[model samples]
Target: MKVKCPTCQNEVEWKPENKYKPFCSERCRLIDLGEWASESHVIKGESFNQQLTPQIDEFSEDLPPADEDFFKH
Candidate 1:
C-alpha cells in the first residue's frame, strides 16, 4: 500500500521495511516532529492539564495532611 506523507504529501510505501512509512524520508519525519514539538500541530480536544487537574485534586484530598511530626519520625 502507498500513502501520502503527512509532512510533504509525497508518496510513501506503507511497509515494515520503510522506517518512515507515513513520511517520505527521515527529513520529512523530523520536520513533522519539529512541528509537534513547537506546538504548531495540536490535537482538537480539551487541554490535558485541565482534564487531569480535577482528578489530581480529588486524589490529593484523600491523602493525609503532612505534619511537623512526620519530619521528626
Candidate 2:
C-alpha cells in the first residue's frame, strides 16, 4: 500500500520488507521517533481532576515519629 509521508507529505510506496514500514526510510522513521520523544506528538485522552483527594483518614494523626537516637549512636 502506498501512503504519503506524515512529515514531508511526499507520496511514497510501502513495502512489507521495509523495516521502517510506513516511513520511506530510516531518517523519516527517526524524525517521527524524535517528535514523539520530544512530546511534539501529543496523545489525546481524558483529563484527570486537578485536586488530589487524600487517601488516608484525616482524623488519624498516628504517624510514627522519626528516630533521631539512631543518628546520635
Candidate 3:
C-alpha cells in the first residue's frame, strides 16, 4: 500500500523493504526529527518537566511528616 509522508506529504510505499518507512527518504525523516529536536513540534500546554513535580498546598497543615523509618538502619 502507498501512504503520504507526514513531513512532506509525498507519497511513499508502506513496505518493510523501505528503510525510511512512512517517509519518502532519509531527508524527510531527518526533517521531522529536526522539528521535534528544535521544539517546533510541541504537544500543547503543560510540558513534561512541569508535570514531574507535584503541586504543594502551602498552607495545608493536614499533611503527615516525613517517614522516620526510611532513614533507620
TM-score for each prediction?
0.52, 0.47, 0.52
Q: Residue by residue across 1-73, what tens digits does model 2's lDDT show?
A: 7898775577778887876657776556545643544355421111111221243222122312342232234
Worst 10-residue lDDT window for candidate 2 reads 43-52
Model 3 misplaced regions, further than 4 Å: 41-73
Please tell me which predicted candidate would have the highest lDDT against the true structure. Answer: 1
Q: Candidate 1 residues 23-57, lDDT tens each?
A: 98775765565354435532122442254434333
Candidate 1 runs further than 4 Å off: 41-73
CA shift of 22, model 3, Å: 0.9
In the range 3-70, model 3's lDDT, one tens digit per residue, is 99988799999999998878997757655653554446431234422432343221122223452332
Better of 1 and 2 by TM-score: 1
| True-vs-predicted CA distance for residue 63, candidate 2, Å | 48
Off by over 4 Å in 2: 40-73
Clashes of 2: 0
Q: Cα lDDT of model 1 overall?
A: 0.55
Would you list the C-alpha lDDT of every candidate in the order shown?
0.55, 0.46, 0.54
